[model samples]
Target: MLMEELPPEAMLDGPPPDADHLLQRTLGTVREERHQAVLRRGRITAITSTFMVAGVLAGGVWLGHGPLVGGTDDEGEVLQGTSSAGANMAVKVTETEGGLRLVATVHGVPDGAACWLVVHTKDGRSFTAGSWRAHAGEVTLAGSAMVRAGDVAGVSVVDHDRRPLVTAG
Candidate 1:
């Protein structure tokens, strides 16, 4: 029955049956057209699905985990360096969301003023992080950038305080 939906082959075994010849011709043409339309629709659907899948894959790749930079702190063994955070510079690193969050208490920067966080990995990979302006007591740096595995994550300021400021713990 499904094959009946398809157009018959052009080759006839012998002389073509004369029964309803014209009607059969019309039906054949219509059937062939319907089959062609179905095929075209199927191709379009396949193409659309492929594109959707590709988009999801590309997005997943782009959303891959960011490199993490973290080190174990012993508090006492670590050196509490001067804050690059300016005046009342008090930089605190806390464990939040399985990542080290750098929070600073500075006196100079005003609310809405942009502040840049410079981070460095153990492999010497350094990059600027998402900016955070002074909000209330401190500015929150981005939390998504993970601390590199088996390495220390260092943080500093730009053009303000370059004092190798890291409290080694």
Candidate 2:
């Protein structure tokens, strides 16, 4: 084989073999790709957060209106009463497992007055449902009676001294 050697000046010839432009192009492409990746991550995070908030709101609505939290409608029979002393009482009676449940809303009674709820049965017997201390505005109290709801002939509220405050049948 024949060997030929080029002069050193030939290597240093034209544009100094520029590589800065190639390096800049490579760096610019890498920077653009990084920016695009960051944008994609931000978009994904925003979408996921929106869905999570929507799901939480839907669950809250379902819980609020569901039967587990008690339906919106009032249940049982409602009775009203007003006494000569100007006291008023409203009672809602519902039949329960072995007796009757009562929710009473009493008004126009003196504050801090001890009151009792008495239930009279059709069989000529009286039963005390519960008692409480009256407060301002409408006072709501809950009680239960051993008698069935249908057997209740009347209901009354009395003071600690047994003076009738209100009565309803």
Candidate 3:
């Protein structure tokens, strides 16, 4: 008879042929491929995390120490001052048509202390440029004086009680 008609105990079979080897090989290949895919994803994640961290650090540094944040200008005159009370200041004086524009960065002052930015003239006159409550860290103040930049003798930071914190010429 034909093969289809000769199936009752005619085929070679005490048991079905073992397919364990084939199955094992197929499973092993699948496992290896999965492992490789996981490794690739892990590497990509690691690299992306590294770049993100580096970018944040770089931005922090730039904002912390850059000329814009530090209140420095190439065209403005820079003055440095310090006080016996451990306060420090850097003043950038720029000449404007109406007056002298002052940008001052002050540090080492007590938090919540009321302070003033005073511009001292060579003629022994003082003009209050700006005022603010001092914070713990660095504080930036901006003010304008009616005097010309050439007439400026110095700049000072004083407390609410007119106590001098720092002065820079």
lDDT by residue (tens digit), candidate 2, 1-169: 1224766667664655567788889999999999999999999999999999999999998764334112232667888999887889999887765577788999999889999999989998988999998888898888888888779988899889888889888
* Cα lDDT of model 3 by residue, 56-116, tens digit: 9999987644353224446779999888889899998877656777889999988898999
Per-residue lDDT tens digits of candidate 1, residues 88-132?
Answer: 344555443354555544444545555665556777775554455
By TM-score, how accurate is candidate 2?
0.55
Q: Candidates sorted by TM-score, descending order?
A: 3, 2, 1
Model 3 clashing residue pairs (backbone): none
Instruction: Tell me the lDDT of model 2 at 40.
Output: 100
* Residue 24 lDDT, candidate 1, scale 0-100: 90
Model-by-model lDDT, in order? 0.52, 0.84, 0.86
Best by lDDT: 3
TM-score of each: 0.34, 0.55, 0.56
30 Cα displacement, candidate 3 (Å): 64
Off by over 4 Å in 1: 1-21, 24-36, 47-59, 66-110, 120-127, 132-169
**lDDT of model number 1:** 0.52
